[model samples]
Target: MSQTRSSAVFGKRKEPHTIIIAHGDDIRHFTVRPWMAALCGSVLAAIAIGYLLATSYLVLRDDLIGATVARQARLQQAYEDRISALRTQVDRITSRQLLDQRLMESKVAELLDRQEELSERNGRMLPLLEKAAGASAGSADIPIPSAKPEVRADIAPANAYAASAVTNSAVAALARITKGSTAGKAGSASIADRADLMFLTINKSLREIESRQLEKIRTLTENAYKTADTIVAALESAGLEIDATYGSSDAGGPLVPVTGAESFDSEVEELDEALSKLDSVRDAATKMPIANPAPGRVVTSGFGVRRDPLIGKPAFHAGIDFRASIGLPVHATGTGTVSKAGWNGGYGRMVEIDHGDGLTTRFAHLSEIKVTEGQAIEVGQLLGLAGSSGRSTGPHIHYEIRRDDKPLNPVKFLKAGKAIGTLL
Candidate 1:
């Protein structure tokens, strides 16, 4: 009975650790220890705790990573926005710089065109001044001052100094911006502003130069016009008839088509024509016998119907006599070729000069004839010595002027010669 009681206690301990399993239409049984059951329950509980810890760790890690990524993205966007602002500033400044350059180029071209126009005006004015100078000198008694004066200007020098100042100022400003890199008012000024300021001053200088040049041109033109009119009046007073509006250009043949710069004005052309006409009239006047052959000499005999000096009766006198001593020097009265230089009927030692336009003069009753026949001679040339040789009662010279062998009034010519002496 005591052995049975001990087995029952052992079996009770075993029975607490026994395990059973039920299968389809079958039963299965297993034995276990109390410690094993406790170990299994502890393992399952540990696995559950480990799974919960792992899930919580994954959730916290994902949340931290998302927060970090969001912060980084915000920082990148801000950096991109800052870069975009800088890029926009640079692009705006560069565009303004290019626009300013184009404007500067256009201004320069306009100034150059004005300079060219001024040059053209100067060219046309020069000829008129020359014309006035020549006319006043030859025709007027007292010469006047000319308009051509030396000119000096300070545009270039002033511009150079000013440009240097502007450039230096701009450079200094730019250097400040670069070295300081300040976002201040001084640094905000851009290259375009500097360029505009510099060019504005330059343009003002150019305009000043142009204004002065224009004034010079106007003064020159007025002076030339006034002096030219004065010359024309003086020329007219000298007995030179000038067709004031005549142009020799039309007197020539067909003009060749010119293919060059047509810069000259009508005033210059008129001056040129006046100069040519003046030359022609001057040449003609010089060749004529407008000078006295014998100055301060008295007329001993008169031409036309008068008493002959030798025959002492009323007769036709073809020549006039000049009272002189023996061996007096005689001169030519006009420019011509000597037609005859020998003795003739009733006149000894004769000299006949054949002037142009059928005008002739006879110097007769001379002691000696110095010019040969057919020899060219000028007015006021010494011809021979005067003496009583033929048809003369005393030492005298017979002078006669004729046209185509017909006698003309010699007194008229002698008076004209004295009157025209001032001009020659």
Candidate 2:
């Protein structure tokens, strides 16, 4: 084999590597270089290493991805928590601001309600104030509210409410109504203070109004008393006693201690009491027989001891004689029912009227009696025709006023009528 290999190499150094394989009917020779075989082995080893590395990477990929995802989730949760905390703080602040706004609005609304109440009270006091003002302006002549009550006619409570002036509180409340809840943080306190001041002013005005109204009511009550006293004096001067009463009341109840603004309400209550009392007095006075029976009449015979015309001697005159033409109408002196419309022995064709409170009047010397017995008559109504009848000196109406069957002087009532134009 060596002698053949050397002889083959000496003849040709370019030796082709060969492999001879024998088959049943064929023989084939294959040749390859050492470098080629090394190349094939190196390729196979690289492929095997690459396959193992790929399989290992596949096995670790899920765990690596899971760790990364978990870390990211933790970071995301932290960020979300921070964001939520911030949002909560903002919400809390907003809620607090909303609560403040609600409180402010509630305060404003309460103030408005108080202003409205004060305004309503002011309205209710207007008529009394007007009456008082008018009466005061007209008269230093009229001594007091009770002296000449005719100036202030009986006014209805409904007519009492009228606008005299727009108060500061009312204006402020009206302005605040348009500026609802728009106040800034610093402005909110300022608004509240201003509202309080306005409320104070309103309360002050109400107090003043109540005071004035109470004064007027006092005046009215005093006037009523004066009028009643005057009437009583007039009746007493004529020896007539009528049942009457003037009350002196002491107020007592649950004593509530008032302070600061609360006194305004108390004053208002007093004013209401005064008004009620004045109203009651007016009602009572309206029913009394305190007016003149004859207006624009000439008194010929005074009520006192006078010379009897028939006897021509000194005699006591029970009544005043009003000289009038025969057939002239004679008026009733007071409101009453006709008790007798027939002739008496001394007073022929006389018409007698029985006034309330045990009071009566006689129209004597009448040609004809217009009012029948049991017929109701008002003061100044035509009772009969004046004529010279039995016990009459001439054609005249012998007007007699009697209380409890006792004759009273008619001059006092006539003077009262002159003093009070309305009663006349």
What is the lDDT of every predicted structure here? 0.61, 0.63
lDDT for each residue of candidate 1 in 295-369, tens digit (9 for 90 to 100):
677987788999765678999988778888878888988788999998886777889988777778888888888
Which candidate gets the maximum lDDT versus the true structure?
A: 2
Model 2, 339-423: lDDT tens digits are 9999897899999887777777788888998878999887678887889988777888788777789888777766644544332
RMSD of each: 13.6, 10.2
- Our tally of clashes for model 2 stands at 2
TM-score of predicted model 2?
0.58
What is the Cα-based lDDT of residue 153 in candidate 2? 28
> What residue pairs clash in candidate 1, if any at all?
none
